[model samples]
Target: MSNTAAVRIDDTPAPAFSAAPMKIVVVGHVDHGKSTLVGRILNETGALPEGKVEYLREVCDKRGMPFEWAFVMDALQAERDQGITIDTAQIRFATQFRPYVIIDAPGHKEFLKNMITGAASAEAAVLVIDADEGVQEQSRRHGYLLHLLGLRQIAVAVNKMDLVNYDQTRFEVVKAEIVAYLNSIGVEPTYVIPVAARGGVNISENSAETAWYKGPSVLGALDLFEQARPATDLALRFPVQDVYKFDQRRIIAGRIESGRLKVGDTLVFAPTGKSARVASIESWGVQSLSAVSAGAGQSVGITLDEQIFIERGQVASLAEAAPAVSHTLKARLFWLGRNALKVGSRYKLKLATAEYAVEVIAIERVIDVEDLANHPGAEVGRNAVAEVVFRSRTPIAHDSFLDNPRLGRFVVVEDYDIVGGGVIAEAGGIHQAHKSANITEVAHKVDFETRALANGHRGGVVWLTGLSGAGKSTIAMEVERQLFLKGWQVMVLDGDNVRHGLCSDLGFSPEDRAENIRRVGEVAHLFAQAGMLVITAFISPYRADRDRVRTIHPDVFHEIHVAAELDECEKRDPKGLYKKARAGQIPEFTGISAPYEAPEAPELALVTTGKPADESVAELVRYLEANFSLTARNQTESWGF
Candidate 1:
């Protein structure tokens, strides 16, 4: 737990960096020799750690298979049975210079998610493109994912030269195609090696074949090439990990992404765009030095000159040009989504350790790798390349994935699951606040305890919604008054009440409706966060829109719909508005002039058409108590802002 709210402490062990081990992630399609190439390197270099070879040979022997090179890396039963790499296996090697840890990732369509996991943290990538099959869809996607993960530094291994009889034309053809795709994805390989892993050609040492190609061998690139800078080192960046308080002073701890962060140096937070001065630099559970300076790869804690509130996902910088912050942005996505990247779809975006719900407003275009141009994608209800525009629910400081990659990438999710992964090409300049969003000190004087005490119990959002006149607002007010008088910090976000004040300028269009619901949901979320029981009474009317709201909470979104019969609603005449709505007084009235999508399933149901307001309020309060903590906490989610 953090002393301050927002930051989350991860339990991953400190990286084993006493020796500054270099990591290379091997990625390519199935049967493209990713495992074979790794096996060949381990064998030729005698870098098979301990009993890897003998154990793999025995496993192969017992399994009644030939001692193929692939067996050395394919450790999982599913991979061995399928004769393919299923999961990434970490194998260490030394090349008489730097110790190398080989990351072997799968190449099949079914296992692309594993590929992402393997490459997400790699310093560099070894993209294997088959000489015979050339560049396949998976190859393109892997390249895209590498770029998204901010690992642009790459080397290509043109494998299976033996199958092409070591033909120079074949290698050149595949190399040309691979190069084109790489450039499209904004990566140019440091070098391309023509190798036959099965035949030990151009792997560790040069083979008798491929003498026609003068490029360095696969081992040569790993041994002798220079690597591009790590993303965290390209810019002066520090992602907030945790904020600790001791002796009434707060210390912020995190890794330095780039340049240098030192004690007493002035720093700015990106996305939030706030500035502060470092008071001290501490390490190893002790203060290292007063105003100490450090470079990339060091985890240090710093005390600010004063209490300038900061939280997780905020980037600290030492440069004049702070990173970009925005409300919404456009992203070019490589869809690994189980569901297609469709227009108007909602998803959860996880960047670093923070996640948010975002909607894909439009699919602008899809890249045709072969054509080398982007067209409106064939969302064809499957994962494909698409240029998507999204509107976020809150302001987020964003960087172009190509610029400062550590903060530029995102994942798309549906419900609570990850559906796609992507890199940001552009942070919507439109969303960048020309004026700052200051954190006002006067909003509420109530602390967490005060709000909790006032609420009679812990306060949260009981987001009741449905079609217009579904009795959402009416029941919500009655519920709010009941909770309020019972010593609860209760508030109702009625649709009309909001439209007249906080959302006065907003109109009733689908886009405006989405924005309206999104804005209200964010406010309610904040209210709940402050430990207040917020009753939101709005006719969200669409399942997707309601779903979008449900995906926001750090916990669960407790949705209770005020489901009422249409004829009964028309007959009640509580406000005499339903009759006027049906008589053409309203253009898009729910249950009459506009569409109303009833909740298919709700945590609690209420029939408000004929029910008394006081009675309905009593029922709502009981429902809130029972389902106050329920949220659509899908592990997979996306945030638009």
Candidate 2:
């Protein structure tokens, strides 16, 4: 049905081109003629093999169905039977300008994951829209996704114009709607043209059906788009893959992801601040070379001048352009997990060659793709986009997504299955005492046994975590008084009192709250190390933040959950916070606007809903005395007295 002739399939090798093939992904709503358009392009460019179209036509006849251009690309039997593309298919074709690899991605919502996988690597995109149907939800979603994936070279093809009788007014209406939506999402489409893909009208040449329209055809628009520049011009980023030993030399092997590397360049391994110079470049089945230079996309092995301990997952870069080293980062994530992505859940963050155990600390906001609206939420549902914050136990090296995409992109894995993908928007600086590189920990001269013998008890931290109005400070004060009266060294670090001095500069934002907890946990650990019972009462809502404190001193950290129902806490309203939060006076108030992640397992749980304060204090005191008291058991064996 196309005006152009289709070429026959050949067995001889095809002619080689000077440049690498440009990859383009075709996407849109289902039943919008994405496959049909791709098939038309193949035929118009004479890229289809001989008898291929006839063979598919015969097959359609046998099945008692009209032959369709979509069948040219939808080669799978299941896809032909179902009349839908379930997976992505790649095909090679050439025009007068250059060769191209067109990726026909599924347009169905259920196959969006496959579409993302295909489009993530594409340099350009052709978004197909049904002219008769105007703009649909999936059409807008696909446009937003292309923008999110950083594809700017886009061409919108208004297909199925024959159904609308090739009316110029109808095509203009569809084009305007799509253009406005794409522009709102910061995507400026290079071209928007009307074409009837079924009969190949206006695919390779301008059609007379739309005499008023004067835009280029689909193939012409593609030729006008520019190719992406090579990444070799960017800063060097070489993530170490492995280290091998050959006789007396140790060879470091990895592919240069960006920029260039040469012999004698001083490279710094990130997060460790270790530097080494490249001495020689190594190659297999080739003669030894000394001053070899390598650019991006080349895998090379090099020997360091001075052998320092280096391992896989360490990124090598110049000191001036080294990646950020931090324990916390902000990301724009697309979650695909069956379970909702919530705060405090743990996942393995795989970025470049490094993998870190990361926990979600906050979900800033979830974005609705249909309306492009942002809503504050506690969790991200399946196939939703959200801005989230993640914290790792140790520092990890990475670049911002805009600075270098290779090191910025990451995937979240839960239980050995990839559940989410994202890009690092921001990397937070070191805020924890343990993360500080300049500080050195000093050891105490007096041993634990000496301090315990003098104080009559061992050092430990009693951390009470709960929602507001949970009687945490009330019970902590009472326990402190009782322990002090019994001639034991005890101190209570009430949240409000500490915030007046130590955390005076912090606000109530999620980042500031996490930092406040880190400071408090460090101070509590110090007090406990001095053989004192340090009691901390605070509304530590995030389980990940509390779990981080436990890791500081696992043996001495005692997490006590002050269990209180939300309604009861609201009814009590100790500080009038619940009332203000209800009145919309306070923002991000826990148990009202924000979230509270209860501890899955704690050292103790006290139900303070209706119980007397004295009873709760008595129970807590008994727990402490039984666990921290040196005289409760054999002191000689327990403390090595």
Highest-scoring model, TM-score: 2
Query: How far in Å is the alpha carbon of 430 misplaced in model 2?
Result: 8.4
How many backbone clashes does every candidate have?
28, 3
Instruction: Evaluate all candidate structures by whole-model CA lDDT and list the values in order.
Output: 0.71, 0.84
Tell me, by lDDT, which candidate is best: 2
Tell me the deviation in Å of residue 419 in model 2: 1.5
Q: Model 2, poorest ten-residue lDDT window?
A: 5-14
Q: Which digits, one per residue and each the tens of the lDDT, describe model 2 over residues 1-641? A: 12243321212222323256788999999999999999999999988999999999999899999999999999888999899998998999876666799999999988878888888778899999999998898898788778767789999999999999999889989999999999987899988989999988889878888767677788777766677667798778999999999999999999999989888888888655567899988888767655489988989888999977788988888766788776678998878889999988889999888899888888998888788788787899987888898977556788887678778888899989888887887655532212333667687799777888899899888999999999999999999999999999999998899889999998775556776887899899888888888999999877757876886667888999999999999898989999999999998788886678888899999999999999999999899988899878567754321
Q: Specify the poorest-scoring 10-residue window by lDDT in model 1.
A: 1-10
The Cα error of candidate 2 at residue 257, in Å, is 1.3
Give the CA lDDT, 0 to 100, for residue 164 in model 2. Answer: 98
